[model samples]
Target: MTSSIHNEVIIFSQAAGDTIHILDLYEKNRKNTKFSIYVIKNKNIYDYFNELDLRLKNLVFIPYPKRFGLYNIQLLRKEKKRINSLFKKHFINSVNHKIYFFAHVYDYLTMSFVLSLSKNNTVIFVDYDKYDTNKTLPKQFYHVKDKMLLTIYKYLVGKQLVLTEKKAIKLLFENTNIKSNKTDEVSSKIKEKYSHNIANQSTGNSVLIFETPTAEASIINYKNTMIEILNILVKAGYKIYIKPHPYKGFSPFLRNYNVSICNANVPGELINTSGFNFIFGINSLSICRLAIDRYGSIYSLIQLFTFRRLNEKDYNIKYLLGQSNEKILFINSLNHLDKILAKR
Candidate 1:
């Protein structure tokens, strides 16, 4: 830990969902401790900040860099002082409090760039989803510029901490040690925000399928497979809800289905799912986040064979920890899924 540190925690967030996920854990821990929290807010999520709780909204200060980049020496020189000041001003007393970054960031190099600026003696990278865990990015970690940055990061920071059971570890290139996953909170707040009336709501037989960018990628036929799954569910009497990835927007293909498309202006993680009996998706990070619950039977559309594009990448690793002990199932085929649904 740093020499002049205090009982404070600073979080550097890239997305609203990741920040919300961190806050869920942080808020639970905050009740029992005297830790001050500040967030390095992502400019993208700032507009929705005011709508959140006043206490949560207050934590979203500590501005992100106006000019970005790690390889750009010009940008680095321009922002170094401001970056250092942001930390010194807010997190001077912050010592062993590890910075929490979602491990599933697309640009691992960019994440490393952020870490290079304010290295905690221990960086706690929280687990999120990645379609291709085995897909290695182009080797840019040991470049001359990166090597220079690495030395600075090491001098500023200490070790690394990962907060995933297993699947998320693949997204991390830097060496890290795993920490136990322990976070549980209710979703009445989410239901209130979304204005979902439980008394008027139907029986808990709804299903939410997250529409991801990778779902419609050229390498796969995820859309068609999902359509078939939805058809099966519709026939089996499951009220379906389709939630598209915010950045990807709506998909025209899903318009043909008998599902309600959520006009969600907020992060998908904040949507109430406890009212639903089953929540399912194809190894999506959002599903992974929501799957840690008792209200819904979480499922991964994990294939048992090389029949789908999901076979081309890493599917679900919940079995590694013990097959579905957490009530999170990984079904192999449509038939397997149907049988399970029939029993339910």
Candidate 2:
């Protein structure tokens, strides 16, 4: 059997951040590759990609069962069959193609389906979040059933799994049987394409805030605290813009404030953040990315609100911010936030 000269690239992405990373990969390999993106059915993600100028062909949307659980053997089997059918419809003779699959490592079902697609294919797992914060096996996966599933997943992927972070590579090496030599970081070509504009500096007195959905779980009145912060900025004459979480559009309460609402469909990292003087978020990875890139004066509101159940992930945001060469400030209280705004 003769193999096609062109490589077939399949991407399974969940959200805007994933889409940005996929875009970087697509732009780099669009020359010799036939690309197909399977977006996990999300209204916001679909809308975001739909608005892009690229007008990508072969974009497929697949439904992810709302109640899908890893341990549910029946559901898992059904889902696997459904996804397999989708792949069969898309690729008539995948064996004759050099297939490349890109997906998040944490998505076990998607990974399983990709593994079943083509035996000779390459699988690259992409994670946009901070590597130190993300765990391949979470605490919930400590159960016997979950452990068995993870073990099976590890074996199926074997040495084919490639991650974007060097820290993640180390973690996988230390935690799993996956060897360091087997895994590699995101290619320098893709990384260069993705971060080409990282050096763009921030200007003007406009402040961009990336809103988080975790506010509902906070001990303090999240709305009130946000309103107070907005009030301070407004009174201090700083133009404020709020980028709502894609999953949870604009908060109605925040509309009352004198702040512009950024298109929630767009990933915060993709936006031209250099237009703003400051960027704020409650431990958002976007803020961390911008901070590392030195796009603006980054600040974290994590210090203000106490969560009912704070975990390592929450603290890791702080660590990531600190890791950046750029100085990122932390707002400890309403008074602290006020003083910081005053100084700016």
lDDT of 1 by residue, 1-344 (tens): 45444334445556655646655555556654343334344443444444554343135445546567766767665566565665566555455554556543333332443355344434455554323243442444345754455444332233231213221212344544323233334354543444432233456577776666555663356566777788888878888877666555556877777777764445656666666767776545556656664424777774532334443444345431122334456777889878867876
Candidate 2 C-alpha lDDT tens digits along 147-186: 4655544543343343322112111323332211212223
| Candidate 1 TM-score, C-alpha based | 0.58
lDDT of 2: 0.60
For this target, which candidate reaches the highest TM-score against the unseen true structure? 2
Clashes of each: 3, 0
lDDT of 2 at 103: 36
Candidate 1 stretches with Cα past 4 Å from truth are 1-8, 15-17, 24-49, 56-204, 246-250, 263-270, 289-292, 304-311, 314-326, 340-344
Which portions of model 2 miss their true places by more than 4 Å? 1-6, 55-57, 66-81, 96-106, 127-130, 136-204, 218-220, 310-314, 322-327
